[model samples]
Target: MGPLNGFTVIELGGIGPAPMGGMILADMGAEVIRIERANGTDPKQMRDVSARGKKSVVLNLKQPEGVETLLRMIENADVLIDPYRPGVCEKLGLGPEVCLQRNPRLVFARMTGWGQEGPLAHAAGHDINYISLTGALFATGRRGEKPVPPLNLVGDMGGGGMLLVNGVLAALLETASSGKGQAIDVAMVDGAAQLMWMFHGFQAIGGWDASQRGANLLDGAAHFYDTYECADGQFISVGSIEPQFYALLKQLAELPEEEFGNQNDPALWPELTDKLAAVFKRKTQAQWCEIMEGTDVCFAPVLSFMDAPSHPANVARNTYIEVDGVTQPAPAPRFSRTPSTVSHGPHSLGQDTEATLAAMGFAESEIKQLLESGTLGR
Candidate 1:
């Protein structure tokens, strides 16, 4: 059994981070029921990995009876994850105010790009846009190049969905002791800003180069903390920051002491990086991995999506698992007594409508009426 075995979460289906938050809750043993639109989302989007370990129930929230039915279900739910624009949920009659009024113990989690109320709250944006406003995007990329978009990892998944999960859990824990529920507002841009705390500290100390990206120590400016191309066109990364580790890197790579010295001098970083790149390219990625894979020099080969599952270290840790013939990441942050597992992969649209309503204690007649009214799609 999982830690959240007895908790019930109602997920209002949307894209990106909201589903990911629900997936995290579901993975942790909560019984998550995704309330999808009756008409369904995009055909191609149904294959999302975040749908794993969740039950789907399609409902037409446009109908007043559908909203009522949803509220009734909320009566038994411990958490409700809302993924919509600012007033969309309120207009649909399922907003935090109304839902919390119906169920005082329900933790309402709202995930948005901008916050619930802000200058840009109503504006449509995506991961890149959200991260851009947070200075996180500007901090990425080479010194003279344009900011690099981090592929939605920073805003959407990490800051947005992960923040919602954390907020929901924190509120849930608080509710457990207070016997009262509260609303959690998670904005991707705000979360992205929060993720920049370390950089903010560096800036305060004048250690970070705010004017030029990729010039900071942790960025690609550091010769010892960047990726290098190998002879086979593959790549490996190294992070020999400490003096001892830096010496080990030089010793193991057989570099001359005269050339590899001055490890911490930023002025010599570019020249040293060029030399390291040339030397690394002399050997294949596999050869480099063999020399430094598990050593203290802080090195590893760059593994891609297709290569990650089969990597020796990943295989040893069971970092990924195959379910129903689909290879994906396994549930993470294992617990000692209540280890989590994927119950199943994403289900077809409305696959659990009837059974879920039945479990919700809806009368057979009520279920049939909702089906007949086209409010509930099976």
Candidate 2:
């Protein structure tokens, strides 16, 4: 059993951040029951890594009986993950007010891109749009180049999903002492902005340049903190920011002291970067790894998704696991006493509907009626 063994979460099924948050809770030993729509489309269910370690139940929320059933479930659920926009849940009669009224200890977490009550709260936006608003997107990419979307990792997963998980866990802990729960309005924009706090601080202290995208120390402007192309066309990243680490990198790469000395001078960065690029291109990623992998040079080969799982460090720590023939990342942030584990892979839609309803104390007759009435699905 893990840290959240005794907790129960009711995840209102949708895609993106909410499912990701639910997966994390399930991994941590919570009984996360996903209430999916009766006619939902999950064409890639088996490969949807975010759906792992959770149970799924189909319910036709358009029906009053289904809404009543969800309310009943919420009564016993420690947390309810609402992925819809602010008004969607209220329209379905499953809003925070109604759910909290039924279960005063329920932590109703609302996950959205714009938050519960803002001018853009009801706007249709995706990860890219949300991150763009927070300056996170603009802060990425190379100099004089268009900002590249770093996939959906920054907003959807990092800002939205991880933020929701953090809030839920903190609320759960507070509930233990207060014996009450509260609603958390988790917005991707807000969370993404929060992630930029360090950069904002750096800019305030004149250590960072906010006007230029790639002119900051950590934003690929410095010679010692960027990725270089190797001879094999592969890439390696180096973050030798500290003085000692920069010295080690210089020594390992055989960079001449006269040319590479003033590590912090911005004017010398472009020239030094060109020199480093030439040096790195002299060897393959593997060859460079041999010399600098375990050293204080703060270096690593930029591996592709196909190659990452096989890395020695990842292999040693079991950072990835295969579930239902799908290779994906393993549960993280290991605990000494209550380590998390993935109990199973993604469940098919409504796979656990009858069983879940029965466990919720629904009579067989009532369940059969709901199924026949189209309020429940197989």
Off by over 4 Å in 2: 43-46
Ten residues in sequence with the least summed lDDT for candidate 2: 38-47
- For model 2, how does the per-residue alpha-carbon lDDT over 1-378 read when each residue is reduced to its tens digit? 889998999998888999999999999999999988877865246478888888889998999999999999898899999999889999988888899999999999999999998799999999999999989999999889999899998899999999999999999999999999999999999989999999989989999887788887999989999999999999999999999999999899999999998999998898888889999999999999999999999999999998999999999999999988888999977989999999988788898999999998999999999999998988
Q: Top model by lDDT, which number?
A: 2
Q: lDDT, candidate 1, residue 215?
A: 92
Measured against the true structure, the TM-scores of the candidates, in listed sequence, are 0.98, 0.98
The segments of candidate 1 whose C-alpha lies over 4 angstroms from its true place after superposition are 42-45
Candidate 1 TM-score over all chains jointly: 0.98
Residue-wise lDDT of candidate 1 within 129-156, one digit each (tens)? 9998888999899988999998999999
TM-score of predicted structure 2: 0.98
